[model samples]
Target: MSNKEQLYQERLNRYMTAMDCGKPDKVPVCFGIGEWAIKYTDYTFQEVFYDSEKANRIVEDMLPDFDVDIFSGGPTLWWPPMFDVMGSKLYKFPGIGLEEDNTFQYNEEEYMKAEDYDDFIANPTEWLVKNFLPRISAEFAEPGSYRATIALIKSSAAFAMFGAAAGAAAQRWAVEYGMVGQFTGFTKAPFDTLGDALRAMKGILTDLRRRPDKVLAACEAIVPHNIYGGIAGPGADTRFPCFAPLHRGAYPFLNPEQWDKFYWPTLKAVIEGLWAKGKRMFFFAEGNWTPYLEKIAELPEKSIVFDIDTTDAKKAREILGGKFCLQGGIPTTLLTYGTPEKVKEHVKRTIDELAGDGGFILAPGGVLMGDAKKENILAAIEAAREYGVY
Candidate 1:
């Protein structure tokens, strides 16, 4: 193996072993690569997207420079393929970057007509089986097809959501046509079908209060997929309760009780359902799951990975001790604004405090955005390698 590959493999082994609650050579350090790496390097987002050679080079460039234990697949922040399959148009900004916003637009007329649930369900499956699957299968049959296919799917999803349109048509279609059925199928195809439904904030909250059985059923459908195991639970970055605040006008109407009544129960079901499926989950509770920590802690111990973004890390550690693997506490904002010295000090302190027991993974509290400072990021990695050695 090449030196970079060898290093990545060694670190990955250590990380996987640590995650399994076994001793490794040390606590391995890994960060989710994002726009920060792309902007810091000379490569542009388009160049990375269009050219595999360049994308591979960029990841390889990061491996030794940062000593990241896990090498994330590039085009890290793109949309999924369901968007293009649903015929959403996309827009882009030359300088800023591609994200969910810059990637797609829903044909509102197409969606408005799709409000009929029964027709909605029939169209997507027929389209997928007749149009999408055959094309995708043939494409995958080509040399190096799987990687290419994943790239296309990821790009399509990223663009459709973030591009200049309202959102992807596929998201609308899923919500309109397949939401209930797909939500039901979550038990069978948890990863593929369960979370595909797109309920508006009000709709989901209402369901929680009025139709909780339906909501729980949806959660149950998706839980079986979680049983096969990877990272269990959900990340807060998506349109769930934890990330609702990030979108403008998403949660202004709801009082805390309403949020608790609606959002919290569904969130609870998602966690509990997956736990019942014999899998542990790591929740990247982005904002503050603090409001719901007690409820979250009610989950099975060490089965959840709670990565808190806007909460007190120290308090989270204390409350969630031996129950969940705490993954992140490092703030991306600090990694951008803080001095190198400050970054190093913060990482050292966090590891020293949180890593005393075994269940911790050193990472930025969220994905590093494209605009984060280069020196600050390097400092954080260096501190982890130096002080994070258990």
Candidate 2:
């Protein structure tokens, strides 16, 4: 292999090894981009979020700027224009709903009323298709509206074409750049699914307090859909694996009792089902997960990576070291505001705590935001080589 090919092979080997529970020569980094990189390249949210070709070019131009390993999908994943035009009451996009520069925020009001819980539990698939779909999308504002039906059909066809084109562009870029891909498929926590679909956060919290039974029931009811919803289903490739982002189940949100009953069971079922399919789950436990470390440790061994959120890494590492690989903990604020020196220091501490024997990868606590300085980003990217050698 040429020197460049050697470097690419080395990077992929390092990343895959760590992800699969073996230590590599040095820690590997996954440069996660979520429109923030496009924004970093001085493009507006509307430009990238709306146009695929422009977005793909921005991504292609920017990859050479970082020393990270994996590419977390491409801009084809964003579809706010559809959401905006569709009149999704659930979310307000950056330019259309909020200020142009602001990030998208969830509009967490209950479209599914408490009285409808039983019906939802009985047949969520039918209920969602019949009752919920028409209510949420702007095109289908009125039930039995033919305009909405036509709008959906046209939108679907248009987006399908864009998706195919965008996917090809991303694959072409991946080969050109020699970048590894993360997660072949994905699914959400059943609780998050339920919270996002039937009960918005505010509505779910209210349900938890007032209707604990229904809260648990509805969350439980979503399990089969969550399991079969992605490649985690039967006869899928275990090699590529699934990336799961979990919210609403961690600390500062629910006590152990509430989480055990309302959150973890169904989520566990999804995890275990995916594991049975030989799929490795790279999970972003997207909140304070300290108290749940032991519970996570109790999961089936060497089949997961916890891309931890804002938690005490020292404690989490002590709890999770042997059973699962760990990723993340570099704060986005540091990348956005802290000095390059500070970025290196923070990442060093993270690697020191998490990169013990093996089973550790480096990444930010979450997706990088618009304000993240390129210099600080560089420092974090280079930290693996500087201080992460085994």
Task: Report the lDDT of model 2 for residue 283.
Answer: 77
On a 0 to 1 TM-score scale, where does candidate 1 land against the true structure?
A: 0.63
For model 1, state the Cα shift of residue 19 in Å: 2.6
Residue ranges of candidate 2 with Cα displaced over 4 Å: 1-8, 39-42, 73-77, 232-235
Local distance difference test, each candidate: 0.50, 0.76
Best lDDT among the predictions, by candidate number: 2
| Model 1 C-alpha lDDT per residue in residues 1-390, reported as the tens digit of each score | 655445545665665554554446665565644566667667666565444455546655554455566432343334424333322232233222355223222221111112222332345445444433333333433324565467457645665444432223213322322210001111222211322233434455444566555554554443433333332233211111111111111123445665454344544555565555444444655565555566667766654566667667878778875566676767989988899999999989988887766667777776566677878878888888888776
Q: Clashes in model 2: which pairs?
A: 86-138
Give the clash total for candidate 2. Answer: 1
Off by over 4 Å in 1: 1-10, 20-25, 79-86, 89-197, 202-261, 264-278
Q: Worst ten-residue run, lDDT, model 1?
A: 179-188
